[model samples]
Target: MTPQPGSYPGLTRRTLLVSAVAAAGTAFAGNGSATAAPALALRSGSNTLNADFAWARKRALDWVQTGKPGTIPSYWAGLTNRPAFYSRDVAHQMLGAHLLGLDAENISMLKVFATSATERRRWYPLWAFQFDGGIYRTDYKSDDNFVREVPAVFELTEKGVRQYLWTGNRAYVDDAALWKYYTNSVTYFIGAHDDNRNGVADEDGTGKIFQGVASYNENGEGLLEAGDGIASQYQALLAYSIAQQARGDEAGAQASARKAANLRAHFEKNWWSASANRYIRGFTKAGARTNFGKENSWFLPMKGLTAPGPRTDAYLDFVHKSVSDLPPFNIEAYTYLPETFFRWGRVDQAWKWFRYVADSRAAYPEVSYTTIGNIAEGLLGIEPNAPASALSTVPQLPSAVPWLELDHVPLGAHDLAVRHDGNKTSALTHHAGPRPLAWTAQFAGRYESVLVNGQRQPAKVSVVEGRTLSSVTITVAPGAKATAAV
Candidate 1:
């Protein structure tokens, strides 16, 4: 049964107020309902660069609201000229929305894309859509515009499934209409475009690295193969696998998983340059490696395809070295590098780049929204795994900032408020859902014990990419206040 538009309701103010609280300690329980807590509020002042943070937060909230209906709910790429839902721009925008916990807005936009079928066939959407649900342009034409048919439809479908993962709302996931669109799009991408039958979709025999009309660099000119396109396909395969698993299709999930693995292997074998110590841009038609440090090299790590080590470190270092050569807020690399560095525990470098985008106030939704996502998801590391009933906090607090706090973070059926000060941490969960929730807190430094609701729990130490992280996990009842101290 497909859920109709507006089927899912937004979170109420009462729910937000009931979930916000300032506390310390951990309390694990099997059965508990949400309890009344302080209203949700973000902390202000010197530690957080309150003025800039406040502006970014408000901008994200306001920008999401500006989304108007098109074939699917769509956001304008920019305020000045482009007034359509572009395939790549919308994907980045929706990802930012998800990071900010704007589930409803994200879902609305997803529905628009999910249901937009091509005119020639009721399957995939065209490259772009006007505000009135009309096709603005497509890559269907041969010659210069041929790249439009490069199978970027999978990117939108992947994001749609990601929205379902974040909200765990059946309205988006189980909607028959959306699944039909998603399955058909994936099928079309595989059957018509994947000429090699090796699980990767290529551009029409162009011998370019990526055959899509759009490149992550935002340069829609020429027929150069792009690393970004290949990485996007890899992500699409993984996302499809997740969708399959969610529907209890074990064989389908396994098949997609195998395909993703094969694609990764293929990408590494062909694209990696051992001498350069990082993946190059892409290969030319004559099997020549374009050995330049293009921004897309960062995409591999951003997609979780790279393990943490010297190679990953070298990649980050390359990005750092390349920054001076790039324009101010080089939209392509800037959008992703900060989050990548933060996730890999390079807080100093992450903060440096993050400050650049925050200061720029770039108007492109793709740039600004991604900057906002970096602050929330990158520095704060507030990952909401709703389907698993868990919220993971891995704060990358830099040396300059003494503390940081985020309030009213939407998790499935709950609003989570988290505050971290140096090595000590505090959190209050206002669970609106019927069941209890589990929480995990990760710290970069070494910690022997973590106090949960004032009771000490043993901390587990794990090394990720050469950096040691101490993590503690505990279960909290709905409406319970818990805190951890290292």
Candidate 2:
């Protein structure tokens, strides 16, 4: 008889690989000192006062667990009661973990997972692991019997690039295991699962999740390929392209880029449903399109796969309505919404969902970590290219926040402070770093010039998500300050 997929009846949003069964000897807190306080801080003053932001920040930082001597760096990103970190949760929580100065943990967790996706396992990494680098047996009875989903693989691949951008960690692009994993995720891994030969990974002719489900929405019906999975694949391919370029493999980079473009083009052309007025959720094993709203439907735009236009706008409006009318049972899943709204320039919606998630669940580790990340990456709009010694700020300050400041934001070698006074004026201070950073100050709408350090500079204009933006790049030396205003 065939083995059944491990059950997770208690979890509304189960892991890509997880088991409901409890594993003995794994029932302990993380293997680390819980005393270390995160150096990262957030502040709000004047009209921009919102205690919710402060509350979430503290709660997020408070969850940090400093690495111990004998174990790899670790944190709690999975079930609050479990002594494990999950790939799905960790991939989602990574940016916040990095901001909290948990770089070692991020690197260790990512590398361990990368190293685990060997040929023997068909390129699927173990879903979760104990803090001490041991596979969490609850989620893994054996390679063939473990639960596995499609989105996590590509999400991990993309997140590796995200971490590299923030930390400028050469290990992301240079590490042998990580580089191999990234390549395999986009190539051999996808190849192994593509039953239709459509250039996208689907189920391996088996509908059973233990064999590999094609979606993050574990409960979805009969899915052979999912929007979330394909969207993640697009991102992973693009990330692999960037990794290739970073490694000086220009030809490989071009090839990966082409693959990403083709995949996106194929998705756009085929995935949209004329009758539904939205993209279908996934395809069934019977080769039928499933029209539904869930991770499968929303992840398309969330992954930056959808082009900015009326279609995207309509879909986002639908998403906001869907979540607002009926919030998800799994609060952890809500963490993805703010980033979704922020990506499309819907500031008010983004903040609403951010605050909502913050207020809803405090125990789930991903909630706290994502709250921290959404504020920095979403509201403050901090984008770092540490490899180039550069940073960009596009403040998405809602009317509710008139002024906000974040201090000790780790950007690779630099610990910088950023403040947003509404959406018009912004400031950056290079608190600590080895070299000056090229800071790009971006403001919505077109302007001939912007005031930088009280001096006028020409603005470079561009359009994104159907909104005009004017930006100026200024160099901020260590122990110095620079301010930009429209």
Score each candidate by Cα lDDT. Answer: 0.57, 0.76
Query: After superposition, which runs of candidate 1 have C-alpha atoms over 4 Å from their true positions?
Result: 1-41, 44-48, 64-74, 98-102, 117-124, 137-152, 184-187, 195-198, 204-211, 218-225, 329-333, 423-426, 445-448, 463-467
Best by TM-score: 2
Which portions of model 2 miss their true places by more than 4 Å?
1-38, 46-50, 65-70, 204-208, 286-290
lDDT of 2 at 283: 84
Local accuracy of candidate 2 as per-residue lDDT tens digits, 244-349: 7766676876677778778877877898888777876788757546355578878988887776689889888888888788845688778899998887778999
Total backbone collisions for each predicted model: 13, 1
Alpha-carbon deviation at 72 in model 1, angstroms: 6.8
How big is the positional error of residue 465 in model 1, measured in Å on the Cα after superposition? 5.7
What's the residue-level lDDT of 353 in candidate 2? 86
**Per-residue lDDT of candidate 1, residues 92-196 (tens digit):** 666566545555555555666666664343244656656655656543452233225343576676667655545556455457767776676666755655555
Model 2 lDDT at residue 287? 57
